[model samples]
Structure formats: structure tokens, C-alpha cells
Target: MTSPQSRKVSEPDAVKLPREIKVLVAAAFLIAIGFGIVAPVLPQFAQSFDVSVAAAAVVVSAFAFTRLVFAPLSGWLVERMGERRTYILGILIVGASSAACAFAGNYWQLLLFRGLGGIGSTMFTVAAMGLLIRMAPPKARGRVSSLYSGSFLLGNIAGPAVGGLLAGLGMQLPFLVYAAALLLVAILVATFLPAAIPVPVHERGQAALKKNILPLREALGLPAYRAVLTSGFANGWSAFGIRMALVPLFATAALGAGPEVAGISLAVFAIGTGVALTFSGKLADTWGRKPMILSGLAVNGVAMGVLGFTGNEFWFFLVSAIAGLGSGLMGPAQQATVADVIGNDRSGGKVLATFQMSSDLGAIIGPIAAGFLVDEFSYGVAFLMATAVAAVSFLFWLPAKDPHP
Candidate 1:
């Protein structure tokens, strides 16, 4: 007969997520869809104001810069207002900012509106992480993380194509569409989510009711958490920032491909990520978080290291897909580790926010640094920089212990 513990690891499908998580997953999908709709057009939209390419690029950077700056405050709000309220408020702010962006009269106005959206983005992002930490079953945290991320991934995959179609109507039209999507998300969460999640019978008491904020200092004491932060930054650097900024340039400059090929390569990457998400979560639970994380880093590192050297379209696409797969493998395990450390009983708003800030910081800095490297040396050098970041993260994880259930 299978032991219960063995079954828990092997048969993750038997673990059911709570209704709140389902609601959050739905919200994640909508948010990703909205964000994706704006992403492809935002730079072009800025260029419409007769700005230089560098100036237009700054508009994109402004949003991430703000997110990194406002992250600590977002964490404080999550602690003060609770996750549901903070989430709703955050989305509402983003929705309103998107509307403002749609009607902006000039470059500065558009920049201001876009930057404001980042404040709300971080607010909700941190709160959502808080919610996941508190609500996910310890045993099923990886599965829960996978479901939420997968929803976002699907929405992201679908949104850009739709956004491309919507852009034909008018550039501003996509902004309006994204705003409407966010409004719908705000309404859905406001109507369906509970004010307070009920704790288990054993946990319910005065002790549970009190706020138990996990200080950033305390969280940093854990070697695994430190590794998580390192990996988060690396992931942001390579996957979030560098991938978006460098991939198209590399496709065109290195492979002698057209713009369409760049788009296809990105799509292929996302599809590869989707494929890995299908099974990685269950494996993270069964095989352990450390192994999954290290494996992901190694795979992503090597794939990226070799990306610049791919001489043909086929090889480039294959490497891109593999990098995406590595990224997908890391997501659930890294998130579940954070959840494990924080646990359901404690508030980790600051800790979660700091972790988020690490990623945001990477997203902001990675491209700028890699861009310099690319300009000075070559695409191969930039990609190698990414590989180095991943290797450093792997080293961080080496001594860290895996989380226990």
C-alpha cells in the first residue's frame, strides 16, 4: 500500500485548492491579459509623440522604476489593509491609470500615467503573493503556484495576438481595452472574494488574529530565502528584462531574420514554458524544491549561454524554447519555497515585498547593463552576462537547505 506521504507527493491532483485561490487564479489571468495587451504597443505609442528611441524607452523604464521604488509601501499597505482590500484597490488604481494613459495629451502626460500604473501594479502584486502564501495548502503550494502562473501564462499567450488585432483599430484602443479588462477583474474580486479567510480549527484563536509580520531581517536569516532572492533577481534579469529587450535585436542582428521571426521565437518560448508548467509543479512537490530550482537554473543558464552562438533559425528557436522551459520549471518551486518559509499563520508582507523588489530591480537594471554589454562587445557577451547571473544564483542555492512540509 502507498504511504499517505508518498501519495501526497505522487498524486497532487488529489489536492484541491480553496475557492479563494480559484478566484485569485482567475484574477491573474485577467491581469496578465491586460498587461500583455499594452506591452507590445507601449513603446510605439510613446514614439508617436515624436520622442527619440531612448526617450521612449525611458517611458517603459519609468514603470519598472516606480514599481521598484513603491514596493516597500505596497508591502506596508498589505499589512495594514489586508490582501483582498489591497488587491481590489490596486487593480482599481491600475484601471484608472490605464484610462488616463488612453487619453494622455503629450509625452510627459503619458509617461506620468504609465508610471502611476506601476504603483498599483506592485501593490496588487505584493498582496497577491501574500494571499498565496497564506492560503495555499503547505503540501499543495507548488501546485497552487503553478495554477496561478499558468493562468497568467495562457492569458499572456492569447493577449498579444488579440492586442495586435486591436491595435489596427487605433493604438489608444488597446489601452482602453486593457483598462476595461482590469475593471472587470476588480469587480470580480470585489464580488466573489471573502473579507477574511477562516483559519483551521487548531489555528483559530487570539494568536491567529494578531498580526505576525515577518521582518525582512528575520527572513534573510534563512539561507534558502537568501538563495530565493538571488534566483529571483537572476530570473528577472534573464527572463523578464533581457529576454524582452535583447531577443528581437539578436534575432535580427545575429540571425539575419526579419521582425516576424522575432515574434515567432517569443511565441515559441512561451509555448515551451507552458509545456513545462504542465508537469513541473507536481515534480517540484515530489522531487523537492532545491532540485527543481537548481535544475532550472542550470538548464536556463546553459541554454542562454549558447543562445547567441546558434547560427540558424532552428537552433535559435530550440535554445529559446529550452530557456523558457527552464524558467517554467523554476517558477512554482521558488514560489512554494517562499510560501513554506512564511507559512499560513504569519504575515510576511515586507519579506514578500523585498523579494518582489529584487525581481523588479533586476528587471530595471538587467536590460540597461546588458544593453551596454551588447553595445560594447556583442550579443554573445550580453547573453554570457545573463549566464553568469544564473550561475551566481545557482551558487547561492547550493548551500541552502530545502523547505520542509
Candidate 2:
């Protein structure tokens, strides 16, 4: 086992970080902002192609699908080439893909570029996260993770407003602007991010690969790691897919709100989530992981159920805010839980990659499954189904013990 004391001191102990970590964190923030800029415009852009609402949703699905396919490969690439090179490569891919998306002439072209962007996104996110984990001390991991998440949250909050403004200029303007931002991020990473020194390979190459890949058997062999996976899936399912699917449907069908109102409501929800995440790191460290995780799921579950039954716009926004609160609170806790379980093992990269894969898979499946229920039955049924999934995650928390350093 790797001892924390033996790990190299890559970052200073002061509140002000070393320049390299700051650059890495800024790169992450910019990448997240670039993604957020495109997110809200995607469905609208797809609709312009004369597709149905369900089909238009495929735009979002395409991105998730690419991430699902490419995230595991990201681990292998990061390990083989080192995090700095992989991270820079991913950012450039995203930038080029975003520019291509601006020039797409048809739905197929748009889908292809969006999927390509997803590939870049997966590599950049996984590599940056791994780099942060590797560089921070075990005792400071929670704080560093929180700072990383907080940067993304700020980007997420700012991106939409910027996206909305640019989108108003033209549907393609957001993509163009996003591409430029991503290009800038790539430059930042290439110029300032520290080169990641490769881990020593074992004499048996197969043994090295096996050690880097967190197999299901080995991952489950650690109960806390399993719980972290479960928590991540639940977070993605409720916090991302279900909320995005149900909120607008409920707004249109139940509350009779216009597209603008629905859009504003969604933005408000995201802002709430960003605000909650601002303090989630400190909360998780002080309060312990289990309570925060359980509380977030429970709050989100009840909010989903309430949104399913209510027809009032006021209630819709209220429930949306509650769901955002739950998600914001849970995000850092889940990351912290993974850090706690994985410790200073070189496998932190692989462990985070696996945990990210579960969330991406949930994100891919959640909307499609919820959409089926909505079409076959009602929006209420879809919301209820999400509620049940969140409820099930609570059980994973019950028997799981916290992994303290």
C-alpha cells in the first residue's frame, strides 16, 4: 500500500496554491464553461432541423453516448501518455469539434460533431480529475476536490447566461464562442500545466494494465468504493437526466408555462445547485460523508415526487430548486468519498475513471428510460420512477461505512 507520507509534495500548504495547480483548475473551469455554453442551445438547434421533441433530445443523447464509449479508454490513454499531454489533446479536440458544430449543415453533421466533442470532454475531465487527486495531499484532498468542483459549478452557472446571450445573437454563435474559449483553455494547459511523470511499470506488462483497471470484482471487494459508485449513479440520474427531462415537461403540460419561463426556471435550478456546491466541501469534511449523501438523495426524491403531482408554476420552480440543492450538496461528497476510499494509490486515476463511468452511464440511460415512461404512461409516472431510483440509492448508504484517512 502507498503511504501518504511517501507521496511527493507537489502543492504548497498555504491557501494560495502553486501556479501549476491553479492552471490545472483553471483549465477544468474553462472546459466546463465551454460545455455549458452549448448545452442549453442543443435542443433548440436540433428542433430547427424539423425533428420531433424526442428526436431532438437525441442531440443531448449523442454527447452522453460518446462519453460512455470513450471514458474507459481515457484511463488507458492517461496512464500510457501521462495526464498533461492527454489533457491538452482532449481540450484541442473539443475546440475543433465545437467549431465544426457551428458549421454543421444538417442533423447528422451536428450529431457527429457533438459526439466528437464528447470524446474530448471525457478525456479532459478524467485526466484533470486524476491530476488533481494525484497532486493533492490525502488530508487536503477534500479541499482540493471541493475547489475543483466549485470552479466547475461557477462555470456552469456563468456559461448558460453567456450561452443564452450568444444564442440570441445566432443559434451558431454560442458554438463559435465556445470553441474559442476551449482553444484558450488548451493553450493554458499546454503552456502552464506540469508534465505528469509516468508511474513505474511492472516487469509484467499485463500486471500493470490489470492494476490500472479497477475491475468490478476488485472495486466491489471494497464496500466503500461500491457505495461511491452507487451514489454517483444516483446523483447523475436524479440531478441531471430526470430533472432535465421532467422539469420542462411539467412546466409545459402542467403549469402551462412558455418556453422562456421554462428555460429561466431551469437556469434558476442550476444556479441553486452551484450555490449549494460552494460550501459542500467543508460540509462533507466536518459532518462526515454518510449523512450528507443520504440527506441529498432523500431531499431530491421527495422533490421529484412533489414535482410529479403539482401543476403550479410556483411549485415547479420550488421543486426544481430543491432538487438542485440536493445535487449541489451531493456532488463534492461523492468525490470526497471516492478520494477517501482510493487514498494515495496510483490507482486513484482508474478509480475516479470507474466512478465517472457509472455516472455517465446513468446519464445516458436515465433520460431514455424516463422518456419511455413519459410517452407510454405520463410525466408523473416518469418522475415517480426517478423517485424510486433515488430511494434505492439510500439503501447503498445504509450498510456502507465511511473510509476515513
Top TM-score prediction, candidate number: 1
The whole-model C-alpha lDDT of candidate 1 against the native structure comes to 0.88
RMSD of candidates 1 onward, in order: 1.8, 5.4
Candidate 1 Cα outliers beyond 4 Å, as residue runs? 1-10, 200-209
TM-score of decoy 2: 0.86
What tens-digit string does per-residue lDDT give for candidate 1 at 1-405? 999888766466766677888989999999998888988889999999999999999998988998999999998998889888998999999999999998999999999999999999999999998898787777678888889989999999888888888899999999999999999999998888888764533456756656588888989999999999999998898888888889999999999999998988888888888988888888888788999899989988889889978999999999999999999999899899888888888788888889899888887788889889999999899999889999999999999999847
Q: lDDT of all predictions, in order shown?
A: 0.88, 0.75
True lDDT of residue 279, candidate 1: 82
lDDT of 2 by residue, 1-103 (tens): 6666544332223333446667877876887787788888989998899888878877888877888788878877877776778888988898899899889
For residue 306, give model 1's deviation from the true position in Å.
Answer: 0.3
TM-score of each: 0.96, 0.86
Specify the highest-lDDT model's number.
1
